[model samples]
Target: MDKKQFVDEVRSIAEGYFERGEFFCSEAVVKTINDVLDKPFDENVTKLASGFPVGIGKSGCVCGAISGGVMALGMVYGREHGQAMQEKMFPMSADLHDHIKGIYKSTCCRVMTRNFEFASPERKAHCIKITGEVAAYIAEKLYDEKVINK
Candidate 1:
């Protein structure tokens, strides 16, 4: 598939996962990344992202989608014990943060959903959309970096 199609597919899968209540925002992003990478980590790797949803376990801090995107990036760019860190890790993660922040003006969950009532369908829809966007952005970045093959 071409780059745009690949990115859109990732976005759709992530959004479907969130919309179906199969996973929250963060989990959906992480799960989609893991799947796209052909399960580089075990399926349970998604648990690492579990607490990130609803803005770090509902503390209403950073956007969980961005947090998940960072974790997804780490799966590709992070280092292991006794291994040198990848130079792209920090820059790519920061780029994901900025990309989402640029769209919403803030990475805070509360701020992004400020106009919606908590637990409302509108808020859920908003989060689902954000989840898809983050997933798509991650796919595009990885594809551009040649981390993901076309």
Candidate 2:
């Protein structure tokens, strides 16, 4: 799909998942990431989030939504490329992270949702919205970068 379509799809998935309360599961997040893009969740994205639920200790350290954003970046920039190409794309990770942080204020669930415990229903709702917004933003950035760089 094109960039606009891709972003729209991500937004749609985010809203759907948020409504269903399935934003915490990595696979569910990955499905959201994939539905808008050309491919399914790549190994790199999942690998990073392996035990990181959100980050560090599943205490929602880095905010799963932001992790999902990072994963989306990895899929596009981490694809096999020559050393030179890889070098340029590597910097995109930081950019993507910054973008995510800017949107949600912090990549951590604690900060984004003000839920250090992460057990409350309010925190859950906040987390879902944060992830959805992050997903939409990242998808848009990916589409823009891919198109411009191509």
Candidate 3:
């Protein structure tokens, strides 16, 4: 599919996954990235992201959406043998981090969700939208950098 189409699809799928309880924010983000990208990763990648929710075991540090976006970028651009690839990968991940943080003054999950409870309706809707946004942004960045074909 085209980049636009892919981004849209990722957004929808990520949101659906979260809203349907198929996955949490972090899991949904990684799952959407895996689905949008042509290459399939080990199923455990999503599991690795499991603890990232609520800001790493709910400690509420960096946003899980940002973490998941970075993971998605790494899956696409990370090198198995060297750090050289990080020059490119890190910037992309940082860009995503910046974008997400710009939405709120802080990237801390606690700060971002301070207005709502974890299981509250508002928090649920907010998390689902952001999870989807991060997933879609990761896909768009990959396309913009020509890491993937349109």
Candidate 3's clash total is 0
lDDT of 3 by residue, 14-101 (tens): 9999899998888898887876676479777899899898898789888888888888888877888755665778788778888888
The residue-by-residue lDDT of candidate 2 on 76-150, one tens digit each, is: 566564544556455666775677678667766666666445677666666666666767776677667563221
lDDT of each: 0.95, 0.60, 0.84
**Which candidate would rank higher by lDDT, 1 or 2?**
1
RMSD of 2: 4.1
Ranking by lDDT: 1, 3, 2
Q: Which candidate should be chosen as best, given TM-score against the real structure? A: 1
Considering every candidate listed, which one attains the maximal lDDT? 1
Each candidate's number of clashing pairs is 0, 1, 0
Please provide TM-scores, in order, for all candidate models, with all chains considered together.
0.98, 0.69, 0.91
Tell how far residue 107 is off in model 3, in angstroms: 0.9
For candidate 2, the 10 contiguous residues with the lowest summed lDDT are 43-52
User: How well is each residue in 61-141 modelled by candidate 1, as lDDT tens digits?
Assistant: 998998999999999999999999899999999988898899999999989999999889999999999999999999999
Model 2 bad stretches (over 4 Å): 1-6, 23-28, 40-50, 79-85, 115-117, 146-150
